[model samples]
Target: MPRIELKTEIKANKNIVFDLSRSIDLHKISTEHTNEQAIAGKTNGLIGMNESVTWRAKHFGIYQNLTSKITEFNKPNYFADEMVKGAFKEFKHEHHFAELNEGTLMTDFFIYKSPFGILGKIADKLFLKKYMTQLLTERNRIVKDFAESDKWKEILA
Candidate 1:
């Protein structure tokens, strides 16, 4: 499995940042470019432990649907989502939040393995890693933007 780690500083409280990070509506807005939408399960609001969501999105010119379940949760501190079914052979995303001197530090750990064995490894080496990292970065950027300002009030309220 390949892992991508990202850390983002948001000038906001950990609770707000944590809630915003798990908000389905915020995810939709962040991934608007990919036309990502939660098509089933908990489609909106803050997702909690043991909950599942199925998302449909256009990636690499193909429409893919991935269903993931919240496997672990610790309020305002950590959470992990694992793939129930998706394009990947395996996938797990862990989110961590810590209070900082000024605001909050949010970290994302995304680990995934592609299918088709050697072909998948080749694709990951060629572009898949970069693509996945870019997506996670963009998502964090949106979360940072919302957490630092009053925009979070809309989705989180």
Candidate 2:
């Protein structure tokens, strides 16, 4: 298993940042690489406790579908999503938000295991770790931009 962690400060309150981060609409807006929709469980609203959704997207030039369930959710603070079905052997993502003097500290922890035995370990060490980190950094940048701008407000409204 490989773990990747990313943190960024957003110029918004914890609740606002958390809400936006978990918003399905916001997810679509933030990533050009994904065409995702909430196919089940609170499709159009804030993802609640134990809710599940399926995301369809193109990754590594191949179409992939991932179904995830919200295993843990604490409003304005933290949440965790675990993969029920996906490409990886196992996947878990944990999101944390904390209010700070300047803004909110948003952190993401992603853990995943590749399917290929020892080859997966080698790939993770050689490339996957950095690739995951970069992807998370891009996601954080988009979220930060959206949270700090009026765009997010308009979308939410």
Candidate 3:
């Protein structure tokens, strides 16, 4: 499995950052590459432990529907989501938030494995890794912008 970690500082409180990060609406907004909707389990609020949601989106020019479950949830701190079914051989994403002097430190840890063995490795080495990294960077930028702006507060409220 390949793991990608990204961290960014947001000019918002840890609680606010964490809450916004967990919102499906924010997820959809941050991930412009994918069109996702929460089809189950607290579709409109903060997702909790053991909850499950199915997100239908387009990835790599293919429509994909991934069913994931919240394996861990610690409010204002950390959470983990594991893919039950998706395009990967395995996938797990852990999100962490911490309070800092300036604001909040938000981190994303993604562990994933491609389907085909040697071909997957080659694809990752050639393009997928960089693409995923860029995607994460863009997502982080959107999240940071949303969290720092008052628009996020209005949406959350």
> Going through the candidates in order, what is the number of backbone clashes in each?
0, 0, 0
User: lDDT for every model?
Assistant: 0.95, 0.81, 0.83
Instruction: Estimate candidate 1's RMSD in Å.
Output: 0.6
Model 1: clashing residue pairs? none
* Pairs of residues at least 3 apart in sequence or in different chains that clash in candidate 3: none
lDDT of 2 by residue, 1-157 (tens): 7888888988887777888878777766655675655665556656768888887777677888888888999898999999999888889999999988879999899999987899988988988889778867877887788789877786577
Better of 2 and 3 by lDDT: 3
TM-score of 1: 0.99
**Each prediction's TM-score against the native?**
0.99, 0.90, 0.91
Best by TM-score: 1
Per-residue accuracy of model 1 over 1-157 as CA lDDT, tens digit each: 8999999988999999999989999999999999999999999999999999999999999999999999999999999999999999999999999998889999999999999999999999999999999999999999999998899999987
Ranking by lDDT: 1, 3, 2
lDDT string, candidate 3, 1-157, tens digits: 7889998999887888887877777777767567766665556666778987788777788888888888998888999999998787888989999888779999999888988999998988898888878877887887788789987876588
Colliding pairs, model 2: none
What is every candidate's alpha-carbon RMSD to the true fold? 0.6, 1.7, 1.6
